[model samples]
Target chain A: MIENEFYSQQNVGPYEYYQVGEFELEEGGVIPQLQLAYRTYGTLNEQKTNAILVPTWFSGTSKNYESYIGPGRALDENEYFIIVVNQIGNGVSTSPHNSGSPIAMEAFPHIRIGDDVRAQYVLVTEKFGITELALVVGGSMGAQQTYEWAVRYPDMVKRAAPIAGTAKNTVHDFLFTQTLIDAITSDPGFKGGRYTSHTEVADGLGRHADIWAVMGLSTEFYQQELWRLFGVESVEQFTQGFLRPLFQSLDPNSLLTMAWKWQRGDVSRHTDGDLAAALNRITAKVFVMPIDEDMFFPVRDCAREQALIPNSELKVIESRLGHFGLFGAEDSYFEQVDCYLRELLASP
Target chain B: MIENEFYSQQNVGPYEYYQVGEFELEEGGVIPQLQLAYRTYGTLNEQKTNAILVPTWFSGTSKNYESYIGPGRALDENEYFIIVVNQIGNGVSTSPHNSGSPIAMEAFPHIRIGDDVRAQYVLVTEKFGITELALVVGGSMGAQQTYEWAVRYPDMVKRAAPIAGTAKNTVHDFLFTQTLIDAITSDPGFKGGRYTSHTEVADGLGRHADIWAVMGLSTEFYQQELWRLFGVESVEQFTQGFLRPLFQSLDPNSLLTMAWKWQRGDVSRHTDGDLAAALNRITAKVFVMPIDEDMFFPVRDCAREQALIPNSELKVIESRLGHFGLFGAEDSYFEQVDCYLRELLASP
Candidate 1:
């Protein structure tokens, strides 16, 4: 495993790990001795009805949810027990990078969105003896897992919010994800995913950042010169100083593992490719929240699935930040997100 | 210089060359001995008023405009003398790949849209003894040159049509072009633009194709599975069989050269970055044609520039093909383009 301070437990954690031994993957592979890294805010109530499960997104860990958890926020730690679970292959969790010898690096098993939810199920029910979750909320890949949680364990999730992500990955998104994978593997220094350090594949990671600069943010962001908001004078400075270091800090294999799962995030597989049938299984009060400018998961795609769910509402968040708006670059983004999420949680 | 049949004179051409002994660039460089590859259809009349100049776009030769030519079409050979000029660094012309050493490959001087217009100016005024053009039209980078021709020598161009491109390349587009350059240079086999052949950087070329698959085509194109229109069974086949071979056939250094020029295509440079003042200088009757779904040159961007031109109308072409619709992939795309060109040609 390539050691990096960015995702190191010591650097970004006040978290804990839950052991999941010999976990079987959805795609016919075994991740022997699976370990899940998670963080919790507040305490589980005597009825265990106040538990809220928040899954981490691609390249994110449990700590990433800290911004949303505060006294007066929708996910107020004082009112509800918010358990933030890092998705599999997200570095802090048992991933390609830290999985040790035999199943390490490129040899790591291909993960699916279903595999992540199934494992999180064990942590929620077995560890905490929780019978139900007050809410399940997340964005992007975490939103994919949120959809899986609502559909797979319908009765357990009372309220669900899948933000800026579709239940079925679009062919457009799958192709976009492929370019990210191609960017990394094309580097010679990657050494077929056996590189000693992330620095070795700097050029490839830089290319990855370049691709993100085009799609991750909205065109208006560039047109309006919004990078200046980040204190960068030029586009080059924004890309080089900000995006490059952020992605370069990640382990390429870990990213590849998440990307592979992200491309194949199809909840409809449970209902023989029938998306309507899969979404109809949800019993939760669902809010399908998509960012207006999100190229990755356009509002139209999200609305299509939202219409299929029996008890759901399509709540679009306005932002000029595109898919990365989930990072809450503008205060208005989080304000809208919190408003809608609070409404969903307060329902019944 | 890597020799490839894709851009070889005999393979894709029945074109001729014009030698401009020593050409000076707008951006402080010289092409020592510049040669412009051109193809002409029909003959110039005694009045020299039936002449139309068509410039090739990036990665295009004079042949790409063939679909819009011939009998009864807007550019009918019987009605007008049509001259198609391949832009600099597009391989068939004096480019990074074909330019002999001292300034070969990565050593090639940077080219601007103004440099291309100036070189073509010599061919039209000096070689053909033509003081005025009946029409100047093109798409994408060709569109860039069309705008430059109208702005730089306003009186020389009587009618101008720039389709699916902008007067000033957007900051969003500059960053998109960077990803394409980064994809090629990041390849270990590229060897800092010193590769032996095009085949040496196959991975990089493939990554370039991957990026195009995401941005070159519109979202609706992929959402509707339009790749099937190309007779490809899957997205992989469309990308591998169609897009990959299309890009892989060209030399990487040649592409980089065009990409660099493309990113800096700002005719506003003529008026100290005052876009409105630069556009207001145009005396030619102009048709600013932008594809409705074109992500690179969105309708808003084109409309913003068109509103500044004194005698221009913003004509939006509805296409699911996005910017690649300029290739005339569908019959409807060409039908719309022809109808508009016919209108522009018959104007008073």
Candidate 2:
């Protein structure tokens, strides 16, 4: 591996590192050398009983999840030793953006939700010597990782909260994710994943962000002029300031890597195509939280999968922010998450 | 102007042509020679009282509207003289693709739904010498024209059926349309609207079509494999076989022109921002028909607008096809249209 310091946890943290060495992916690919970039807030007590594993979502970093940690919030670093682990393709991890030639861009092998969970398992069990988690928590693709962690290693995860995502990606969501991928690759500047920099495919990234304007938020979000809350007056301004810049700042190949994993996100893949059986294997208590207005992962879809999970409870988060609600757009959402987490932690 | 017969009504008929010289657009620009292409399925009756006008939707041609204009259909050519006018900028009509200098590609002046309705008015009054229309009917962007006709030339249209669209585009729909536009313009191949062939921006068109895959249809449409109705098994097959080719065949600049018109589709623009007043101006008996699953123009949005039209009846067509339900995907939808149109025409 190239091992660039800029992508290392030390550079992006209050952080730490776990070297998994040669990591094998769920989809039959291998990284010759793998490093997981993670950040830990607060301290791990003697018993390691307060540890919470927070997995990064698609196109997200451990830094972004830092907001949910700290003193009084849901993760509450004051009480819990929160570990925010970056997913493989999110640039800061063993991603196409920072990996060696054999596993970069066009050659970056397929990854899955299970692969990330397995890596997190290695980190939890081998590196920290922590065998059980107080909670496995994340949203969107992070939520996917949470589900994978609980289902794949049930006893290790005492409780899990998969927010704004499903155990198995729905066909509708697959199509949406596919469209997003198409938006990027179709940019001629993408150059078949051989672009020199993210700017080369800026237009592609812009279009990809444009898809988010439609799929990632509710109609009421635009109708109520919530873009104004972000300090932009027009849709053009919102796109320019927030939507376009966010996607353009990330590597195109990195995005493609995460997107492919997102599309193939089914714990059932390991359980011989039986989703209920896969969900049934999860012995950990699960809080299945879905945003009411999330068009991509509608609550109805989450409710369906929640029914299949034997020890899961469905907790619907009402928010006009839609899938982006996990970002703390509304105060009530944070309160809801705090309440849900408190309840999950308090349960016998 | 380059009056190639392929672009003219001569080659693209069952179509006729009407020249409206030196036409001024709504947004303060003029076309030196504007020609409206049209197709009439049945003969003009002696009284001309039976003439019904059908306008084309975005990217649609008069030929495509032929399906709704037969003996037993909505327009029922046997009883009505159905005139299917191709909307301006739809390639076959006077458009950026086939127009001369100062009006091609990037130079093409913004054309509004009102401008199209204005052009159609000339075609109806001057060429055909039709004093009154038995009905003015269309779907999607065609429905915008329908609303414009009823509001602008109220007495001239006896009845109007605007299907699967709204009197004014909603903020959500506008954002969706903007994304579609961005998807095209962001293509580096577009080169600021100076591309050689449509193939140059095939990727852009493909991405644009990808947005439609999300916005133009419902989840049930994908889940039930309604794409199979068009002879495709996978979503990829549907994208390749239908969606991409359909947009690619049309001119990008022309598509943009129509999209711009579609986005600014407010009859309230003519009635001083009072939508209810604009709708109330309709002397024609109106049938405000919306597709049940249409995300673009949801039934709730349609119902809200329809409530403003004094002589209108709200007819909801139940289907899982979303906005595409207007394309006669289900025989039930066609039957609903047939019944609605028959009822409207029969009313005093």
Top lDDT prediction, candidate number: 1
Best by TM-score: 1
Per-candidate clashes come to 0, 0
Candidate 2 lDDT, A1-348, residue by residue in tens: 323344444645666667999998878979988888888888888998889999988878887776677697767888988889999988887888687778987799998888888888899888888988999999999999998988888888899999999889888788789888988887779989888777898888888887888778877787677877667879778877898887887788889999999998988987899999999999888999999988888887899899998888999999888888777766788889899989998776
The per-candidate TM-score of the B chain, in the order shown, comes to 0.98, 0.96
- Residue-wise lDDT of candidate 2 within B179-209, one digit each (tens)? 8897788777888888877678787787788
Worst 10 residues of 1 chain A by lDDT: A1-10
Estimated TM-score for each candidate: 0.97, 0.91
- Tens digits of per-residue lDDT, candidate 1, B1-348, equal 667888866777989999977998877878899999999999899988988999988788898998889989999999899999999999988998888776798788899899899999999888888889999999999899999999999999999999999999999999898888888887778888888898998888888888988988887888888888778899889998999988888899989989999999999999999999999999999999999988778898899999999998988998888988988878899889889999998997
iRMSD, per candidate, in listed order:
1.0, 1.8
TM-score of chain A as modeled in candidate 1: 0.98
Error of 2 at B160 (Å): 2.7
